[model samples]
Target: MHPSTLMMGYGYEPRLSEGALKPPIFLTSTYAFESAADGKRFFEGITGKRPGGSEGLVYGRFNGPNQEILEDRLAQWERAEEALSFSSGMSAIGTALMAHVQPGDVIVHSAPLYAATEKMIDAVFGKFGVKWVDFPAHASPAEIEETIERAKGLGRVSVIYLESPANPTNDLVDIEAVSALRDRMFADAEHRPVIMCDNTFLGPCFQAPTQNGADMSVYSLTKYVGGHSDLVAGAVVGTRDALAPILALRNTLGTITDPNTAWMLLRSLETVQLRMEKAESNARAVATFLKDHPKVERVSWLGFLDPSSSQGEIFKRHCSGAGSTFSVIVKGGEPEAFRLLDNLKTVKLAVSLGGTESLASHPAAMTHLSVPEARRAELGIGDNLVRVSIGVEHEDDLVADFEQALKAV
Candidate 1:
């Protein structure tokens, strides 16, 4: 069956809990075991002393009725062997990076990453002596190879990280090329690098990084997966080997999402396909309107990508859909961007994306400001760039809002 069809009840059984059609929220901190033997086995699994083999819940941090069901549904959607949830997007990313990265290791990352992620790698992880190296979003395959080589010179390049349809810029990164680069750079089995792709933008719906050889695919479930702005959550989906360490770190750090959030995610997962499809359609209309507006200088949207463009071919090959988020560079800088933003009546001027409601924010000052000014400029994100997360709003109404906002600008 199609994913949308499966989303309705893929991982849940109606009779599993009190014959209720929907899964109930298991709100307790821990679950009861059948006996002392069962408790010992569950504890052993939680602490990695033994394999529970999907028998029952252990601890709130390891597994729960709500979290287990949600992970099963999501893992199936992502075509992953296992999935893990976290408190927030950053937590998931941090746990994944920290699990594989260690002191004296290097991470080769793509440009225009989320400011929080950049700060985590540079400030937080750097204290532990982990090195950060940036690779151009538009770099040729050969150039990417060289970038990996340069990082290897500093130390062992343990991870190749990428944020495709990058935050703020809506740029594309070649997952297959990256996988190739990882293989070529770390052909030596002992020094191999794991490829991790931030699939938040395209997601388990529009794009699957693991299909292109990514070791792990991460998402800020707070966005499309949650589909509502009320919750904060993140997810990691990959093979058990690649995901086990991340899951272990999540347990130790207590970064797991609560039962309520997990239940909400399960609810949201059911409608993700419908919501994303509608949002993508709305985005196409919005991007086209922004492109023709005199006040808009440029638009970085997957919908408007040309086949002739360098990144265009990669976009065509990797992405089944041009996700719902895109950025517009106004003719003037921050002032004009703000003018348009302030004048909008339908869309809220806020951070975060991929919810049912439209949201807009300035990348330079909002999401990516923590990135150094020099690095921000080098990545081409200016004060003029305004990122818009297209929601389920009517395309005509959204276009009207943009029309009025552009007039004000």
Candidate 2:
């Protein structure tokens, strides 16, 4: 069955709880053991002495039916063998990276990363003695190889992390090329770098990173997965073998999403595809409107990629749809961008993307503020850049909003 079809009821049995159509939230701190022998067995499973069966739930943090069901659904969506949910997207990224790397190890990542992630790698992880190197989003396959080789000169390349259709700016990273690069670089070595892709911008339906040779796929479930801005959550999905260590770290660090949030995700999963499709439609219309506007200097949207360009070819090969979030460079700098943002009536001025309501923000001062000025310029996150997250709204309404807002500038 299709993933969206399966999402309606897969991994959940209606007969389990009074024939309830929806899974009820298991809002307890822990579960009761059937017997002392059963408790022993559960603990043995937790300690790896025995295989862990899905039937038993020992504690909320360790396991829960809501979390398990949600994980199962997410794994199904991404075509993954297993999945782990986290309290936030950063927890998922941090725990997965920490599980794979140690002191003196190096991480090779693509630039224009989400600001928080860049800070975590450079400021927090750097203090812990792990080093990081970055290649530009549009780096050629050969340039990526050189970057990896340079990182290897310092230490093992433990992780190759990438955020494609990168935050705010819709830059495409070649996932298959990076995966091949990892294989070529580590052909003779016992240790291999794990390729992790952050698929938050496009979501699971638009792009499946694992299918493109990524070892693992990560997401800020707070965005499209939740569909509403009411909850904060994240997810990691991959083969069971690839996710084992990350899950182990999640268990120890208590980074698991709570039962209520898991339940919310479960509810959101039912309609995510519909919401995303509508948003994509709206985005296409909005991008077209902005492209023809006299005040708009340039628009960075996946749909607008020149077919002859290398990035466009990569996008054609990997991504199925041009997602809703993209950037617009106005005629002037921050003052003009801020004026347009401040004048928008339909789209709210906000930070996060992939929500039910449209949002717009100045990336230079908002989302990527932590990045150095020079680096931001190189990434094309200019003072005139304004990022927009198109929601499932009427195309005409959104276009009119942008028209009036641009006039304010």
Candidate 3:
């Protein structure tokens, strides 16, 4: 069944909820067990003393019916074996990193990470003696392999982190190529590194990382999955074996989303496909209009990518759409870019994307500001770049709004 159809009621039963036709938010911190033995059995299963088949609820932070249902339904989006939800995107990311990393391990990753994440790796992880090495997201597989080889001098490589259509730039990474390189490089190692892909920019609708050989697919549910900008959440999906440590760490850290937020996520899932379809169409039209404008220097929308190029081929294999977010470099520098942003009446000047309303952000000065000046320029995050996220608005209206805004330049 399609994700849209399954989202309605895949992991829930109406009769279990007093025939209400939808699961209620079980707003309780603790649950009643039938007997002492039942409580023991559940804990044993959770702690891995018993392999499987643990039934009944325990604690809200540990496990709840709403969160379970949300995880089950989300797994179907990427066809993953298991899924876990968290209070926020960074919580999910931090917990996943801790589960697989240790004091002496290294993280070899693609550059242009979300600003906060890069800062966390530099500040927090550095205190524990864990090191990180990075290369551009567009680096060839062989080039990335050389970087990994260089990282071995520092510590054992435990994680290969990536964010495709990376943050504000929308650069595509070859997930399959990286996975193959990891296999070739570390076949006889003590423990091979895990490929963790952040699917926030184009997930659930267009890209499936695990299907392309990544060990885990991570997401900021605040973006595409939540769709309405009403809630904040995150998730990770992978095979049950790959996720065992992550689940254990999540329970220890109490990072699971609340029952109420889980219920809201359930509501949003129903219309994700529909919302994404409309927004993608609007983005294609918007990019086309901007491409021909004399004042627009470049539109980094993937829909305009040359199909014969390496990046385009990888995008074709991994993503089904260009998605609604892309960056535009204006003819003039920062002054003209700021004018366009200031003149927009309908679209918002905002930091976050994938909301119901359109938004524009300056990558160099706003979103990716934490990155150093030289590094930002190297990553193609120029001062004139304005990252635009198209919404489900009428294409004509969106184009007209952009046209009027560009006139200020």
Candidate 4:
């Protein structure tokens, strides 16, 4: 069945909880065992001590009915063998990377990452004796090969991380090309680095990284997956083998999303496709308007990519649609960008994206402020750049909002 169809009822049974059509939130912290033997069996199953049947829940941190149901549905959507949920997107990413890398291991990642993620890799991980190297998201296949070779010279490459339709810039990394490069470089090695992709920008509806050879696909469910901007959650979906260690780490870190948030995600999944479709349509209209506006200097939207470009070819090969998030460069610098953002009536000046309501934010001063000015410029995140996340609003209303805001600029 189609993912949209499965969202309505998959992995859920109405008869299990007093005939409730919607699954009731299991708010308990622990589950009661039928017998001492049953408790032992559950523990054994979780610990992989014994293979058995009728294994039931042990604790909320370990497992819950709501978490299980949501994980199952998310796995199905991504065509992954298993799925795990986390308290936040960084928790999922940090735990997954930590699970795979040792103290001396190296991580090769794409540049222009989310500010928090970049800080974690370049600063926190470095202090712990792990090393990292970065390649541009638009790096050619040859450039990627050189980056990997350089990292290999430093230490063992344990992971290759990528974020496509990269945060605030709409830059894309070719998943298949990177995966093939990893395979060829590590053909004879005993341990091969895992390829992980952050799919939050495009969401599950727009792209599936697992289909393009990613060992894992990570998401900030707080974004498009939650849709209403009311919940915060994260998810990692991939093969059961690839996820086992990450799940163990998540369990130890106690980063599982609460039952209530899991329930909210379940509700959001049902309408995600519909919400994304409308937002994509609205974004195309808004981007087109920005491209033609006299006050706009440049628009960085995937839908506007030149078909003859390499990034465009990779996007056509891997993605189903150009998602709603993109960045616009205003004609002037910080002062003018602030004027436009401050004058926007319909679109809120905010940091987060992929919500139901339109949002506009200045990356240099807001989301990526921690990044140095030189690095920001290299990533095309300038003082005049405003990241816009189109919502499910009518196209005309959204365009009118931008029109008036540009007038202020």
Candidate 5:
């Protein structure tokens, strides 16, 4: 069944909720067990005293009605076996990484990552003796394998983390190739590293990372899934067994999404398909307008990509679309780029993406600032690059605003 069709009512029965159409917020922090025997069984599953049959909710930290239902819907969107929500995208990423690695373990990651994520590697993960190695998002499978091999030499490669259709740059990463190599290299190993992809840039509608080869697809639900720019949440969806450890970690760390946020996500998922598709359509229109402008040096939207190259093939094999968030390099460098952004009257100057209204920001000055002064340009995110998050705005109005804004440049 189509996900949108099922989003309204799947995993929820109104009959159990006083016949209400929508699921309630489940505001309580704990669930009441029928008897001591039932409570013992629930705790047994929670404490890992026994195996499986852990669906029974014991506490808010472990499970909640709204959280569980939202997870079910998100898992359906990614075609994953299970899903878990978190307080924020960083928390989700941190949990996913920490679940797989201990001291002396290594993480092989993709470059041009969201700046805070890069910071997290050194600030949080690094302090614990975990190491990280990075490869370009556009690297070939062989090159990536070389990076992983190098990571293994430092310590056991416990996680292969990636942010594909990379932030600000919008470059595609080869998920299928990475998954194939992981299988080939670790087939006989008892503990194989997971290929975890951040699907926030494209979300589930534009790209299915898990289907392409990733073991887990993570998202900052603050962006696309929430749709209205009102909530802050994150998610990870993968095989139940693969996510069990992350779930346990989330429980232990108390990073689970609050019931109110979970309920908001439930409301947002109902229209996510409609909202994202509209935004993508607007982005293509805006990208087309910017590409022809003399002041715009380059419009890095994937809409103009050639489908025959290796990167194109990788995109074609994985992503369903180019997505709405992309970068534009303006003429006259930083001064002109900042001028254009400052003069914008319609599009808001902001950092976050996937909202109902368009936004424009300088990645070098804002989102990717943590990438270090020298490496920012090396990563293809220069001072003149403006990252635009297209929204469900009227195409003609958006183009007109950008056109007038460019006159400042």
Candidate 6:
């Protein structure tokens, strides 16, 4: 079934819960077990002592109606066998990292990552003795292989994390190439590295990382999945084997979303396909408009990829759409970027993306601000680059808004 159609009643059976059309928020912390035998069985299954079977409710932490239903629906959309939800995107990311990484292991990540993700790797993971090596967005397939070889020389490579259509800059990475490299890296039984992709930018809609051989796919459900800016949540979807540990960690860490948030996500999922399609159309129109504007130095959008461009083929093969997020480099630096941001009336000057409303942000001083200046330069996320997230608004209105905003610069 189509995702939009599935969104209405996937994973949730109204007949299961007093014939409620919508799954009611299982708003309690504990559930009543039918008997001591039932409690023992539930705990046994949760702790892996016994296999889980189709049965009655378990402890809230172990599994709740909201969490289980959400996971079911999410798994269907991403085409994964299972899924787990977290309280926030970073929690989902960090938990997945923690599950696979250990002290003295190395993680090779793609460049132009979301700033917070960088902090988790550099600052947070550094304390635990996990090392990192970055592969730039424009790096060729050979360069990625070489980087892995170099990292292997230092020690073991445990994880390869990628954020394609990388935040701030709309550069695309070849997931198939990376997956092939991962197989080579793990050819020896001594070391096997997991390939994880942050698919938040163009997730279950435009791209499916697992389809291209990624071990797991992550998303900041706070963005496109939530649709509106009201909810903050995250999710990781993968095969049952890859996601079981993540679910266990999630339960122990207590980073699960509440029933209300899960309900909101369910509602949002219904409209995600429609919302993303319109947003992508709006973005294509806006990007075309920006390409012809004299003040815009360059537009980094996958939709604009030239046939000769190195990333063009990868984008064409993997991405269903160019996504709604793109960055434009103005003639001047921070001053010009801010001037354009400040002048926008319809598109708000904000940090988050993938919402119904358009938003513009400056990487140098906003999302990527925490990244060191030197490192930021190396990644090509410059001060002049202004990121815009097109919404379902009128394209002409958005174009006019950008035209007027460019005048301010």
Candidate rank order under lDDT: 4, 2, 3, 5, 1, 6
> Which wins on lDDT, candidate 1 or candidate 2?
2
- TM-score of every candidate: 0.97, 0.98, 0.98, 0.98, 0.98, 0.97
Clashing pairs in 5: none
User: Which portions of model 3 miss their true places by more than 4 Å?
Assistant: none
Residues 1-409, candidate 5, lDDT per residue (tens digit)? 9888889989999999999999988889899999999999988887777877364988999889999999999999877999999999989998988888888788889988999988988778888898999999999999998988888788788889999989878888999888988898878877799889999988878888999889899999999999888999999999888798898788789999999999999999999889889998999999999998888899988878889988788888888888889899988788999999999988999889998989999988888777788889779989889999999989999999999999888
lDDT score at residue 109, model 4, on the 0-100 scale: 95
Q: Model 3: per-residue lDDT, tens digit, 1-409?
A: 9878999999999997899778999999999999999999999987878886347788886889999999999999899999999999999999999999999789998888888788777778889898999988888888888898988888899999999988888888899999998998899999899999999989989999999989999999999889888899999998888788898888789999999999999999999989888999999999999999999999989888889898889888999988999999999889999999999988899988888889999988997888899988887788999999899988999999999999999
Candidate 5 local accuracy as lDDT?
A: 0.89
Kindly list the per-residue Cα lDDT of model 6 for residues 206-232, writing each as its tens digit: 998998988899999999999898999
Which candidate do you rate higher for TM-score, 1 or 3?
3
Q: Pick the candidate with the highest lDDT.
A: 4
lDDT of 6 at 245: 74
For each candidate, what is the lDDT? 0.87, 0.90, 0.90, 0.91, 0.89, 0.87
**Candidate 4 deviant stretches above 4 angstroms:** 50-54
lDDT of 1: 0.87
Q: lDDT score, residue 226, model 1?
A: 88
- The TM-score of predicted model 2 comes to 0.98
Among residues 3 or more apart in sequence or in different chains, the pairs in candidate 1 whose N, CA or C atoms overlap within 3 Å are none
